[model samples]
Target: MQGKAGFWNLSNKLTLFRIGVIPVVALLLLSPGRAPNLVAAALFLVAAITDTLDGYLARRRGTVTPLGKLLDPMADKLLLVTALIFLIPLGRVPTWAVAVIVARELAITTLRGIAASRGVIIAASWLGKVKNLLQLAAANLLILHHPYFSIDPHRLGTYVLYLALFFTVWSGLDYLWRYSRL
Candidate 1:
């Protein structure tokens, strides 16, 4: 049991490492005159994959820890926020979208912190998960420059970003309403 727990812990740490890589990857992709966008996109994709794998492994292996619970969401938010921030000034994404998403994240983080103080674990909701998936899809599309399988990258990216923005606002409000009733 001890050994198994240690392995899961290690996996959790790796997830955090992947999360930390997002900002660097974003900067690399955003740099002017650099065609390294594809490389950066690959890194982002790897990080996103690891995010899914780590959580699934933790649950299947029964290695979920309080630390993992805390760090996992933090990592997700960091990656999303960093990617959106980088994409905004490039005109690939709108400032309003980033602002709304970031605001929602901040509100949820604050609510979670307050709830945790009272020993309440505000579990991730289905809406929240959907919001996350949409956000991830948006980030990936934007980073990939929307050219996957002959898709018009720029237009597709804009559409996805807008969709993600809508979900972000919806989920944020959902959380607020849920919290009020609790």
Candidate 2:
């Protein structure tokens, strides 16, 4: 049985699974037709669910490892960034909003790297987590990109993306401000 200190704990496996799903999700998103879009959205939703589950499992099971710490956020960025970029070509998401979100993600990731190098750990704040959740919601809805059950996924996704942008900027600025003070 894998112990809490083991590298291949269930949580880390889920994180790896999320990363592995990225390419397939990207392919589905790029494929033409509503069927492909729906599949991509479903896959993305699964990935998003794993995102939450991995963290919770890691914390609850005490199997949190350095690999999990590093890859969890990377998986999120890769999935979200890939989806948003593809959505741009599909005319589902605004290029500027994607740009802003991507910029913030890259900046914060860079900031975290710098902090790590200096023996500092910049943990994910609540605002940052909320930003990620909003981004995931937007990406899923935008990938679906169609009306269903009286809800316009595209329109709702746009609104959620806007909320995501606000949190992205806020959390990023918060990180920078804290880092600057250190």
The candidate that wins on TM-score is 2
Once superposed on the true structure, which residue ranges of model 1 sit more than 4 Å away at CA? 1-4, 7-10, 146-149
Tens digits of per-residue lDDT, candidate 1, 1-182, equal 22357645765876778877886787776676436667777788788877788888787777877778778878877887898788877777888888898899999889888888888878888888888888888787787774657686668767887888788888889888988744
Q: Please report the TM-score between candidate 1 and the true structure.
A: 0.87
* TM-score (all chains, Cα) for each model: 0.87, 0.92
State the lDDT of candidate 2 residue by residue for 1-182, as single tens digits. 33456998889999999999889988998788889889989989999999999998998888888778879988988989998998898888889998999888888888888888899999889999899899999999999997889999999999999999999999999999989855
Q: What Cα-based lDDT does every candidate model obtain?
A: 0.78, 0.89
